[model samples]
Target: MKVAMIGAGYVGLVSGACFSEFGHQVVCVDVDERKIRMLEQGEIPIFEPGLEKLVADNVAAGRLSFTRDLTGAVADAEAVFIAVGTPSRRGGGEADLSYVYQAARDIAGATEGEKVVVTKSTVPVGTGAEVRRILAETNPGATFHVVSNPEFLREGAAIEDFMRPNRVVCGVESKHAEQVMRELYRPLFLNETPMVFTSLESSEMIKYAANCFLATKITFINEVADLCERVGADVQAVARGIGLDRRIGNLFLHPGPGFGGSCFPKDIRALAATAESAGAPLRIVETVNDINESRKKAMAAKIIDAMGGDVAGKTIAVLGVTFKPNTDDMRESPSLDIVPALQQAGATVRATDPEGVREAKELLTDVVWCEDAYTAMEGADAVAILTEWNHFRALDKGRMKKLLKQPLMIDLRNIYPVDEMEKAGFRYVSVGRRAVGN
Candidate 1:
């Protein structure tokens, strides 16, 4: 199979590489000449775990390639994947489909024969229909099938998710399109992966619904964590007790600053806009968005309150700036809100992340960026763990105690145990739980 992935951002680059790994001849197309050049030299522009090695291996084997020539890539490909971004539009919260539509126009112009045009980007319901209409209008005689194939790859674990997806959902109108999709995903068939065949609208809805539901679960648990704090209960034990239930099956139940990444925040907002436009608003989703924003903002206050009702003239050590660990994505990270709020409140902040420093430098300012967590903590009044990076899980308590001016700690991700932190001679504050050594 020959696959051409358009818009070589995170989704395009990862999907194109993974397709090549599956023994398909893949060419990734992007408008950015520098990014394509970087890929040619095996210098991945994005920081995804194992992605560079995967691309390097496939390129070495001559199965994968990158190019700025979209027409050349599409003319020889069996499947053209539109994996461009669909960010939330400013002021409206609706998904901006301009990029997707432009990609469709480009693909339509470049497409030669019968091609399976798969939308690997997350789009709203009826987007596939719109894309198909655009393609037909651009090239009236062109024969192509627009299939909705939304990606469900988690940022940090995208490679693992793509290689071993639980199920592959594809929306196709014709049997011929279905067969092409099956052939494209033939590797997953060997593992008996469930391939869901549904209507284009349903396939589009599935992606938004899945992301919004997960966002709701995170918001629910975060609210529960707040209740646990007020009632003097342990949220971790509470999460475990409910997670053990077979029906509930614990995931996204951990209480944290809030759900913040490339997907949830934008998807939920888009979903709400979609619902309202259709005359059936999803009030729960709207509330989830509101509550999650409040949660992120509230975390700054939590840190300030922990530091003797004031952070004025305080130096706080912030561990982890990325939205999550194992990836250097700082999109919609809680640190984006917390760090700025702390600075506004007159606190001098020092931060460190294993992978997020470079990207964080672009988004965050006026903070002392350090090489490691302990270095960031040195001379700080308190230390706050925003993202649960693995290195932060096993920090030397004595060293942490010696580093900070005050033996205060805020575990926003709840990575550290209260009893253990208490035993280490530090006052610890965490989400949805009672403070230790108060």
Candidate 2:
């Protein structure tokens, strides 16, 4: 199968590479000439684990390619995927479908044969029908089937998620489109990956619902963590106890600073907006958004409180800056909220992340970027663990104690236990658990 992936961002790039790895000829198209040039020179734009290697291997095998020429790529493709970004629109909280619409218009002009134009981007319900209408208006006599095939890949584990998803949801109206999609995903079909075929609207709702549910789970645990702190309970144990239940699985139940990433925050807002416009308000989702947003600021306040309620003249060290571990993406990271708040509270912030520093440099300007964790902590009054990276997990606690002047530690991700930090003779504060202080 020949696939043309429009908008070679995270989703488009990873999906195109994975499809090419499945032995399909894929051309990843983008408007950014610089990005295309970088890809042409064997440079990957993002730092997804194993993505560069996969893309390199596929390109070496002549199965995958990158181009700035969208028309040329779409013209010869059997399936054209609109994997462009649907960023949250300003003022309305709805998804901005400008990129998706632009892709449809371009594809309509270029497509020569009966093509399956799949909405691989996460959009509101009826977006597929909107694309179909636009295509009909643009081409007048072209035969094309618009399908909704939303992506469900996590940032750090995107490659694995794409290759071995729990299930694949494809929305199609015609038998021909369904057959093409099934055949295109035949490799996964052989692996017994259940592909659920449904209406375009259902498939669109599925993506938003899944993301919002996960976001709600994270927010629930965060709120529980706050309650645990006040009531002298352990959130980890509570999470484990509930997670053991067959019905309530423990996937996104870990208490942290908040849920901040590319998908959850934006999708929840968009979902809420969609419901409101349709007169079916999603109150839970709206509250989830509000709670998650407030949680980030509250986390920053916690760090400030640990530092004797004043951080203005202190040198505060942050251990991690990315939204999560394993990926360098800092799209909506807690650090974006935490760092600025720390600076506002009168603290001089120094931060270190294994990979997020480059991107963090753009988002965080006032803070000093350090060489490593130890450097970031040097002469600091307090240290806060923002993202739970592996290196931050097994840190030299004694050394960190020595590096800081005050020896106060705020473990937002709960990477270190209270007993362990107490053993190291440091004041340790963590989420949803008892604080260990001397």
| Candidate 1: tens digits of C-alpha lDDT, residues 295-343 | 9999999999999889899999999999999989999999999999999
Give the per-residue lDDT digits (tens) of candidate 2, residues 26-78.
99999999999999999999999999999999999999999989999999899
lDDT of candidate 2 vs native?
Answer: 0.92
Measured against the true structure, the TM-scores of the candidates, in listed sequence, are 0.99, 0.99
Task: Judging by lDDT against the true structure, name the best candidate.
Answer: 1
lDDT (CA) for every model shown? Answer: 0.93, 0.92
Shift in Å, residue 383, candidate 1: 0.3
Worst 10 residues of 2 by lDDT: 398-407
